[model samples]
Target: MTFALGPRAAKAGYGLVAFDQAGSTNAEALASARRGDTRRSWFVTSEQTAGRGRRQRPWIAPRGNLASSVLEVLSVAPAVAATLGFAAGLAIETALRQVSLEAALRSGGRASFALKWPNDVLADGRKIVGMLLEAEQVAGGLAVVAGIGTNVVAAPPDIPTPAVSLADLGVQVTAEDLFSALSDAWVEYFGIWNEGRGFGDIRKLWLERAAGLGQPVAIRSGHAIIEGIFDTIDEQGCMLVRTAEGRLEPITAGDVHFGSVASQGAV
Candidate 1:
């Protein structure tokens, strides 16, 4: 099926590209960035044969799933650009909430959707979506690719954290349908980002929807594993963990696992 942009995405002049099959949507977006067309291009595919997530973990995309990436060139510093993950993460939560609400009405049980530390979306304690952010220094500024994968119809059964799909929750949605909602939600939340001026609000909303707050969580950074309270995500989007020694430490990058559900993972 030919993929078409929704009204909001089309009006924004986003360069929409879709493929029947691809290795990785993020790889495709990165290639487009190298060609100097990374203004607001979105690359999507139904199935990914070579997709990899943060820490180079393989992301297997079966036929019934959603995988897409958006590329944007920003003049902001790479440090500031790194926080865009929160914007994209919140957008996914918002978009998926709408879909889940519909499913809730049908199933007669409200499906709880939440944001995990760093940038992941969870539905009722199971990972329903994952995101990966990639960046490269370009001529004028930094080009960042926001890659998002949604478990629309199915999830990897053998993964560390349990995975759940929309279908598993009684919601039937197509990749095209989810992508359309995501594109529109992206525009909405990114506007709230307001060139990072509205990060405070974004942080507030993210924390409000966060999971495992005030709860014990474990993080594996490199060779060391640190267990602490899932304190908060600071304004700069760092995870603040209050260690058992009563010291509050901010983590810029690490893999987070909540309670006993955590497996060897990445953020």
Candidate 2:
């Protein structure tokens, strides 16, 4: 069965689609987009069996978690889709803040949530959400699918890092409510994209919510690992890190690890 977005989301012009179960929202979205679907849809699932993360890592989605993929059919180049990932990250951060604040108000507890560079959302320094974006070439341009998985009730057991849930944090949020907030956030974030701003605004917003800035970190790209101080992101969305040898390195793609030097690490 398919689930549609709520009235608030409908007013935002996002077509919300929900599924009881799916292998992967990103996979389903790509398939739908290739078939020329112009729905501008948000595909949310109750659970995902084969969710994927950056660099083909496994994305765990428990029953009560949030699993969603937002697809946008773009007339721009595929490279622009990469910039959209930054926008998506910012959107998720915004949504987290909204729900966390409400949860805090309801429970009278401290609300703590932060964002890791690229696309990881954390609560009290433990990971609570992760995102994966995939793009495909359609007839006219590229179809971008951004998949977001947020732990709401249960945590996975196989990951190296510690995982936390909203329930564990004293914030009880339902998957549907989280999806509503996310859909609204995406509508606002995508407006920046439609303006042809080229990720400048998104970059600024990301830096504001960034977990590590001016800190030493390690970036793993392909077979090479570079250890440096995280400086800033370049215009092309590449990560700028200062190495131990006092050299500046631009990272196009890699896994970032926060160092132990109160500012330096690698993942």
Q: Per-candidate TM vs. native?
A: 0.92, 0.92
Which regions of candidate 1 fall more than 4 Å away from where they truly are? 105-110, 261-267
lDDT of each: 0.83, 0.78
Off by over 4 Å in 2: 1-8, 195-198, 261-267
Cα lDDT, model 2, residue 262:
29
Count of backbone collisions in candidate 2: 9
Query: Which lDDT tens digits does candidate 2 get at residues 1-267?
Result: 235565656886777667888889999988888888866889888788899888788886868788999988887766767778777887777887888888778885445776777678878877888888787888746788888898888878777457888888788778888787888888888887663464787788778777778877877677777887888887667788888888889888877777573244444
Against the true structure, what is every candidate's RMSD? 2.5, 2.3
Clashes of each: 0, 9
